[model samples]
Target: MLLINGKVLIHNGEGLNFVKADIRINSSTIKELGEKLTPLPDEECIDLNGDYVLPGMVNSHYHSYTNILKGTSFGEPLEMWSLDTVALGRILGEREMALSVSLGICDMLRSGVTACLDHIPHLATSHIAAKTYKNTGFKSAIAPMLHNVSDREILYEINEIYPVNGKHNKFPSVKDYVDYYIDFINRFHDPKGNVKVILGINSPQRANDELMKAASELACRFNLSIHCHLLETRWQRLSADNDISPLFKLDKFGLLKEQTSLAHCIWMNEDELDLIAERKAAVVSNPTSNAFLGSGIFPLKQYIKRNIKIALGSDGVNCGTSNNMMDILRFLLLLQRTQEMDYTQWISIEKGLQMITKNGFDVLGFDKPFGEIKPNHSADLAIIDKNSFLDILDDSFLNQMVFNASISAKHVLIDGRFVMKDGKISVIDEEGLRREISAIKPYLGKNMRKALNIANEEKKIYKSVYESLLISPSNIQ
Candidate 1:
């Protein structure tokens, strides 16, 4: 396939530059890039009609289950929000899980995201989510979470603040979790295919020694990458008992390595930051989700100074605003600026763009080079109609796309195949998907109401704990 007459965004030695080039794709990789390239007699050709082509963006951290739960929750802290999400997750069977995954894919492709690290929280329906991604030909690293601790145990002083009479819910045993992962890996773990399986630790404080050890061994044996939540809130940071840092705990289990990507390192100290940089691990910052949950801001300046690879994520759609990487990038660029006083030290548009694109691919640890529109790179490109957003094209077009424009891909390709073309998704029957979702709305509505009621009761028990921590003195710097 030959794509001609397009303004392609390419990274020169200095920075990203736009060049008028024709891209030649052979199978799943880009073969050549040049101007006025002629097409072969038997080759299919697509005229981009002077559109702007970009490397496909990636949603570094996301929860596919939350796609159906959008608009279901007002803003709440991470711990409190989890109550509602957990309840809702319990009601979703295989059918609901598939539709939810499909819905997230449709939302992501419309906004030019071609890949993601889907950190699934539910173990029962995780295979459903993975199969959905596989069938749609979407690139994803499906991570079924592992954590035996209850929510109350991970929050600092929550038990003390609101004492419970009986024991908390029993989680699956370490052996159970490990066996499940092994079976899941054997069934769906495909490093060379569209879907891959990675180890998902819910959080360090939440996992016991046995589980962490198993996770480390599994990762080592399978050569899998690790993705998990890390210190997203002050209460979570305080949950590290006996002055032991969460990073140290992870390292003790041999889980902190280059292939590890921790999400939401917002409440970390300089020592933790240095440790992450030294270990060559990556951190995914979800700006919109942090702000929405009232979690502390990520130390972007500190992370950048440490030379840690930082990528962007949208997080859960219900917690954050949108699945759109462009929206996330825009929010991140603007939000990070408020943290730095020096204008010169603020993140540049180029750096922000990299976070949503190449940095994400780095975090996923895919062997084949992607997130670039160059020869030998994976042909995952988003052909966008810049004219839809920009009336007049100029040098500031990229800037406008980041800050002012409403961005959507006119055509999206993943692995040299069109998943979305001419503003319509090609891999799935979107109209049928909408109808399925609509057909179940009444059932969903009834269940969601019950879930909210359950969440409210749970929230009452934890509300005082949340308030108490807000006024407590902090030792963390």
Candidate 2:
């Protein structure tokens, strides 16, 4: 495949520059780059017609399980929202799981995101989602959320506030979950397929020491990245039992390392930030979700100043409400501007571009070179119609992209294959997925309604307990 006559952004580690060039691809890897390449016989040629080509953006953190549950909750903080969405959203069968994951990836492809780290809470149907990605030719790192706490236990903790009686579902033992993750890794880790597994600890508050140590050992043996949530809410930080910070505990267990990527570090203090930077760990911020769930703003300037590798994520469709990285970038840029008073403290458009691209590659530890367009790199790229939003002869493309929230990809290529062309997905069954989702709508609705009723009954008790804990409504609203 040969792509010609495109304005390409070349980032060669030092800086970014624009060049009019042609790219040659052999199978899945980029083969050559120059002004005008003589095409070989039978080579598929595509004329970009002066369109703009950029490396596909990477979503460092995401959740496909809630892809089917958008707009289900409103005006609730992360804690309360999870009670309604995530707790209830897990009630999905294999077929529903497959369709939902496919739809999520389709949305991502349309928005020019070619890679992601999908943090799945339910282990039962994660393989089904993985299968959908494999068939659709998308890249992902699937990390099943590992936590020892059972739903019944959580309900009990909430019940202390209001009185409700119910039996909790039986959960697998700690060893059982660990063995399942190892089995999942052995079965699904494939570099050629562009899909792999990572170790996941939902949070230190939910996972026990045994599970954390076991996950650390397994990740070391396999040399995989460990994904975790760190201080997303002030309530979460206050709820810690001991005086020790969660980062300290994680570090003590050898889980805090260069390969680990922490998500939503919204409530980290100065000391925690310093420790993370010292450990050379990476952080991913979900600006839209943090704002939607009323979680506090992440200290973007602090991370940048400390030299902590930062990446951006959309979080989940249910919370962030969109898979579009363009929108996420806009929100991130604006939020950073509003949070810091110093004009120089805000993130620049050039730096923001790297956060979604090259910085993400470093956080995810992808074996192949990606997040940049160059010779011998994976041919994962997005083509945007320059005329769609920009005026003729206007070279301020970065400013237009960062300030506008409606920009989308005209075509997307994953590993040299056209996953989306002419603004439509070509590699997956888009219509079939739509039909399946429509067919299952009533059943999912019925199940979720029942779950919501149960949540409401329990919320009465949970709310009073929340008040007793003195959790500010703004924190979890």
Candidate 3:
């Protein structure tokens, strides 16, 4: 296949340049990109008609299952937000989880994201999203994450603005969490390509020494990359294990190798920052989610200075508020400038554009010849609306993409195949998924209503116990 006659917005280091380029896709890679390319006799030619071509957006952190938790958790801080989610998750089943993932995938595809790292729980239903990614032409890193913490003191703040909840679970040991990893990869990982079962830990608060150690061993044994949420909130940073940062402790436990990825280090200090740069562990930034949830500004400038690999993610439509990578890039640009009170030294339009394309691929360890459009690179292209940037050209393309571009990606391709076009899913039947999704709501909610009713009754009894305690304290006084 040859994509001929396109105004390619080649994201060159200096700036985005408009070049009259023709891309020849031979199988899963770009055969050539130059002035004139000879096409094979049997090759299919796609005339972009001078449409703008850029690399597809990559999301390093995403929660596909959290899409269903929307509207209910609004205005709550991170702590309350997650507590609300815990209540919601108790009601969710396989079907609801699958529907939420489908909705997340569809939104992400339309929002110009071709690749994503879905940090999902080890649920049978969540695996449907992983399966969908494998069958479609989208790139992905699916980590079946688990949390097993025995103490509340070790747990970090779950959300930015929310207070840490007291200890509520102590049943599952860290060793038990490790045991689940073996089966998780066996069932979900596709060694052929497309899907990879990256071992992911949910958070430091829910993890223990044994769990962290086992994760390190598995990653080393299988050569699988690691993904985990670490040192995100202030409470997590100033927890009982104050000896070091979460990344530092992970490294000390032999978990912070080059293959590891930590999400939303919003509270990282200088020493911790240095360690991440030294270890070469990737940082997945969720700027919008952090900002929206009142999570402090992440150290983007410092990361850029140290040349640490940084990637972008929506975290999930629920946490992130949307599946728009363009919006993330836009927010990041203003965020860095305002945080530092100056932008000239740390970040720029070029860097923001790179985050969506090249930098994102780097986080998944695929940048060199996969993220960018060059000879022999994988043909993962994002076709943007030419009219969207007509008012800006040359250096302005970078400005437009970072500030003015729409979140809707328009069309996307991975491995030289079109997964989405004109905001429609090309690989899956949207109508069928919609029908399945509609049936799921009533089914799961009905069961949830029953469970809630039982909980309500139990709570009534529990309330009496609380009242008795209050009166008993008065009588003792």
Candidate 4:
């Protein structure tokens, strides 16, 4: 495959330089990238018509099936009144899971993201989503989440709480889940290749100490990145009962490390900041989701000063906003400025762009193949319609990109194969996905309606359950 005749933004602020270059690939690796080379007469040529060709965007953290939750919740915190994840959990079979992942990836791809760290809760079906990348050729770092809070029985007693919507089915043990993930890593992680697995947990608030320790141990043993959600909600913060704060508790349990990557460190105070920077862990900042959930603003300036590697994520833009990683960047940009009331405190375009593109690949622990477009790197890239926006050019590329170039990222490639081209997907039937998604929505709606009704009934039944159980309603308050 050859990506020819497009404006190339090699890396953030490498200062736009023009090139009449050719990007050549064989099998999966980028065979060559430099000035125009005469092709073997048989090589196919793609005319960019002056578009911007760059390394595809990388999503550091995202939920595969969470796209269904977009637009439904106006302003709910992470803990309450949010549409049920369990609802989506009930109706998604392997097919629905694959389509959801495909939809999410395609959304990213079209918006210029070529890679992601997907947080999937169901292992078997999560594998199906990862497999879509193999078929579609997008890069992915998958972490099947393990969330079972057995040790918080005291909290369960004190607060008389259950999982939101109470949708846990057949809990898998920590070791068993770790064993399953290890098998996934063994099968998927390609240190010398592209698609891989990261050791993962859903959140500290939702996981037991055993799982947390096991997750870190497995990630260390395999030398893969550890991914998790941290401080996502106020109630989650309030749930901590011991002297050990959740951040330091993981540290005490030997979980924090250079290889750990946490999503939504929104509520971390100064101490947690020091711990994260000290350990050299990475964070994926989902500004859009943070805004949507009304989770407090993450301390971006604090993290930046400490030299923490931060990446950007859409967080199933459905749950957050839209899947355009650029929007995540834009919102982060405006929000940072607005919250600080100082423009300089805002993460600049150059730095903010790196979060979505380069830093994410760095966080994934794949230094060579994913982010920058260089010789021997995997051919994962996106081509944008440079002329699509007003005043678009190399001169205005950066400005246009961060501010306007977001949705203009119309075409994408992974491993040198055309996954999307000319503002349309290359491999999968975009319409077919829509058809499957449409066909699936009603079944999901029916099942969710049923489950929600049952859950509502359970909530009614349990109204006095907490009262009788010696847990005060004000505890939840």
Candidate 5:
């Protein structure tokens, strides 16, 4: 395949710059690049027609279960939000799970995202979701969530958040989950293919030491990348016993490694920050979700100065409101400047692009030739229409693209195959998928109603206990 006459964005050692060139792809890798490359006999040709071609964005942290639940909550903290949504995920049937994964895949492709880390909550439905990704031509790391703690355990002090009256829910045993995850990995993980089944530990607060150690063992056993959420809230930071942070606890469990990727380290202190950087572990920052939940600024500048490997993610549509990596890039750039008065301290457009592309490849531990347009690199590219209204504002195409974020890919290629073209997904019937998605509402609603009932009953009991803790005369003294 040959891509001709496109403004190709390349990382020229220092920063991302563009050059009018053509790309020749052999099999799934780029074979050659230059101006007016002659196509070999029987090679297919795609004319970009002066459009901008870029490396497809990577979403290093995402939750597919929440994709179907977008716009359902507003003004809720991460604690309250998790009680409603993660619990609701327990009732989703196989069909509903498949639809949710498909919705997320289509959204990512439309936003020029070629690959993602799907931090899934349910393991039973992962195969269904994995099959959907294969059929849709999307690359993914399907991570089954691991945790031993229950909601009651996490919110023991504020159990009012839990509903008092509801049907009892029994979670799968740790052994049962581990067996399922091993089977899922053996059945789907392909070293030579684009899909992989990774491991996920929910968090230090939610997962016990035994479960965390076992998760680490599984990751090392399978050589798969492991991801877990860490320290996204100030309350979590304050609640750590004896002033030992969650990161320290995770490290103590032997889970911190080069392949480990921690999400949303917003409240991490200097020691935790230094620990992650020293271990060469990756950190995925979800700027929009952090801001939406008021989790606090992520200290992006600090991470950069420490040389910690950093990547960007949309979190999930439910929290971030969109799967567009460019939108996250814009938010990441602007949010830092708002806090730092020094112009040199703010995140540059180049660094933001690197996070979404190059550092993202590092997050998954993929050694494949990717995140660049040079020779031998994977032919994962997004062709953007450069004639948008925002193009006139700046000569730097990257600056305009990140700042405006109003452009979509005119065509997208994953592994040298066109999965989307002319703003339409070519691998599936998108409209038919949209119609099928409507069936999921009743399932989601059923679980949500049950959750709300439980919350209402527990609220009064929890409030009484909580008020005593706050206003008791002995407590005051």
Candidate 6:
């Protein structure tokens, strides 16, 4: 296939530049790129008609289960918000799970995101989510969550405030979790294919010694990448026992390696940051979700100074503001700038673009190279219609894209095939999917009300304990 007459964005060592060029795709990779390239006799030709082409963006961290639960939360801290999400997640059957995954895919594709890391929290319907991505031909790394510790156990001084009763909810054994992962990997894991399985430990504090050891073994056995949540809240940072950092604990289990990508390191200290940089691990930051939940700002400047790979993600849409990667990137750049007094030290638009594209590919650890428009690179591209209102200069195109424009893809390609063409998704029956969701609206609404009630009741049980922690002195200090 030959794509002609487009302004293609390419990274030219120092920064990004748009050049008028034609791309020749052979199978799943770009075979050639140059100005006015002649098409082969039998090659399929596509005229982009002066559109702007970009390397497909990636969402390094996301939870697809909450795609259907947007606007369900007014506002709450991360610990409190988990109650509502956990309640709602329990009521979703296979049908709801499939629809939810499809909904997230549609939103992402329209906004030019070609891949994502779906860090799934529920294990029962995780396969359904995997199959949905596979059938739709979407690029994804599905990480089914693993942890046995109850929520109450991970909070500092919570046990002192409310004595531990033997009434905590039962979880699957370590053997059960390991067996499930092995089966899931054998059935769906494909490192070289569009879909892959990753080892997802919920958090260091949330997993016991046995489970952590099992997770490390599974990751090494399958050669899978590790994805886990880290210190996202002040209370979580204080939860560490004996002044030991969670990063060290993970390292002890052999889980903190080059392939590990930790999400939301907002509460990390200098030593932890240095350790991450030394180990060459990546950090996936969800800026919007952090602000929505009142979590502190991520130390972006510190991470950049350490030369750690940083990628952007729109965490659960129920907590985040949007699914668009551009919006996420823009919000991150603006928020990070507020922390820096020197204008020259602020992150540039080019770095922000790299965070959404190149850094994400590094975090996913895919076999083939992605997020580039070079020869032999994956032919994952987003063709966007140039905005007449913002296309005043070649140099200012990226600036307008990051700050002022509401970017959407006119055509989207994954592995040299059109998943979305002419602003319509081609891989799935989007209209049919919407109708199915509408048909179940009444059922969803009823269950949602019940779930909210359950969440409220659960929240009441821990409200006083949470308040006590808020007023308590810092355990870390």
Off by over 4 Å in 6: 161-165, 241-243, 475-477
Give a tens-digit lDDT track for model 6, residues 179-221: 9999999899987878899899888878888999999999999
State the lDDT of candidate 1 residue by residue for 1-477, as single tens digits: 999999899876767877789999999999999999999999999999889999999999999999999988799988898898898888888888899999999999999999999999889989898888889888998889999877575567875553443366568989999899999999999878788898999888778888999999999999999999998987778777444677888999989989999999999877899999999999999989999999978888888899999998999999857989988989888887777778898788888899988899888766677888889888999888957656465567788789988788999999999999999899989999999999999998899999899888988878778887778787764
Residue range with the least summed lDDT across 10 consecutive positions in model 1: 159-168
Best by lDDT: 6
**How many residue pairs clash in all the candidates, one count each?**
0, 4, 4, 1, 3, 0
Residues 233-314, candidate 2, lDDT per residue (tens digit)?
7666655422457787789888888988999998887888999999999999998999888888988888988999999888
The residue ranges of model 2 lying beyond 4 angstroms of the native Cα positions read 12-14, 150-169, 241-243, 468-477
| TM-score, cand. 1 | 0.97
Clashing pairs in 6: none
TM-score of each: 0.97, 0.93, 0.86, 0.87, 0.91, 0.97
Q: Predict model 5's lDDT versus the native.
A: 0.79
lDDT of 4 by residue, 281-359 (tens): 9988888788777777877888888999999887765564777778788888877887787666666676777788778
RMSD (CA, Å), each prediction: 1.6, 3.0, 6.2, 4.3, 3.5, 1.6
List model 3 lDDT by residue over 223-285, tens digit each: 788888876654455452444456766877777878888899877778878998898888889
Candidate number that wins on TM-score, 4 or 6: 6
lDDT of 2 at 369: 77
- Looking at candidate 4, the ten consecutive residues that score lowest on lDDT are 150-159
Better of 3 and 5 by TM-score: 5
